[model samples]
Target: MVEGDTFQKFMLDALEIRGEWVRLDDSFAELCQNKNYPESLRKLLAETTAASLLLTGTLKFEGRLSIHARGSGPVSLLMAEATHERAYRSIVNHKAEPFESDDLNHLLGKAQLAITIEPDKGQRYQGIVPLEASNMGDCLVQYFDMSEQLDTFFMFDSDANGCFGLMLQKLPDYRSIQDQDAWDRVTQLANTLSFEEVSGHDNETLTHRLYHEEQVSLFAQEPVRFQCTCSPERSLASLNALGHDEVLDILEHEAKVAIDCQFCGAHYEFDRADVNALFGLGKMH
Candidate 1:
């Protein structure tokens, strides 16, 4: 496996804090392939993908984590998902107009960001907040502050090569003013990191550079990859969800039912015979 698409977790042993670092290379490129997204939208999707993986790392169950953003501006919808096994995918819907601004709030006006967690054997949970900040990282920080009541810091970057992210969160053990100061110190040090540094440096070097003076324990790195969950069977199930009459109408008009997976651009076609089998009408002679 390539080291570029990797996720690593670490802890500041003495500071009662934990963090995660992720970098995406071939996986990121694969996710963006065949989709001619504008530069800004591409970056936004990449960052969302990275953020999804980071959140997935925090999960204690065997399931998936997803980040969804719906806005009323040029960018209408953006979604990213990552499973416990590290498979990930992302998609973005935007207008044809050129988005020249770098401000996220301007590009995605009045957006709502939602994070959803679906456990394998339990109920799903979701948290949603208004996208008020110019940066997604800051918006996520606000989410943790309000929902989790934990101080969290996030740094994310995307460029021609790949997308990268670093996250730090204070644990509940911080009871004294001294612990709070230590948490502030670590977060401030983390804030000093720039896009160039996060994008250019490896996890080991980045961690060492940021917290060399502190006793940090790094864990084994997990690999992340681009994998779309869409399949012909899944597409057929969706067509079934549209009800038999609607699908029959589509097939009657188009001669066949065609569906495209937005995440991977996979095309699935269901001819008359396939539709007959799907609806238990038997094969057409």
Candidate 2:
């Protein structure tokens, strides 16, 4: 099996198109290990995670990019986030029974997909689109076409072993007659990619097989890992957000307050002294 948990960028020199490939093995396993998700939900979450990373690779920002979905189905909510540094986390909230179908529309029934780009120093940008396709790849392609006015192609796959994705996008300069022809040809070739080829082969072999006649430049691979941004201080800040009275009410009822990080399952506990310190008062015995 190919070593996973890395993102690599490549440029089709002759086609004026750029692309990215990502594979998640141990990182995917780590993210899913702690959660008790049905198989259908697991696959959807994995695809979302791969899509988030693929989109994040195209941006030159210092913040995070997130893909979110909400619907009126058994799977009510699904979310995935990837930072500029390539750290990622994902979650799925759904009803307990195993889904009988893996179709995106059936699993997500009447869902809306939201893509948000948050820069470290600027206002966040978001685009919303209805989940109109049978799969995530087609839905994202539709989003870019309608929202960004760019031609894009996406292929993604995930199973019990790992998850992987490939994306090809026509750059803005691809407008000439020759460029248009090249774009069409490259996208057609990209469309022929099978999940087996994407998840089973290494980057070099895969790209070469797909675009052997074109001049392709494979860039250095960036490492991607599973990481959660949860800490005691952050949890305390959340408690403060609920107001002093609310915190006291919870503490009075439970004797101690506990908060769990949804991403990594880390637990944060607060006793009376902890709550008092958060409110700028001296600790109580």
The most accurate candidate by lDDT is 2
Clashes of each: 0, 0
lDDT of 1 by residue, 1-285 (tens): 125999999999888889999889987887677788788888888888899899887898899999998888899888999999888988889887679785778778888899999999899999997888898788889888988898888888788678888899887786543655787788889888887777667788889998999899999999898989999999999988998899998877898899999888899999988888999898556
Model 1 bad stretches (over 4 Å): 176-178, 276-285
Candidate 2 stretches greater than 4 Å from native: 34-36, 276-285
Backbone collision tally, model 1: 0
Among all windows of 10 consecutive residues in model 1, the one with the lowest summed lDDT is 172-181
**Model 2, position 114: C-alpha lDDT score:** 96
Candidate 2 clash figure, as a count: 0
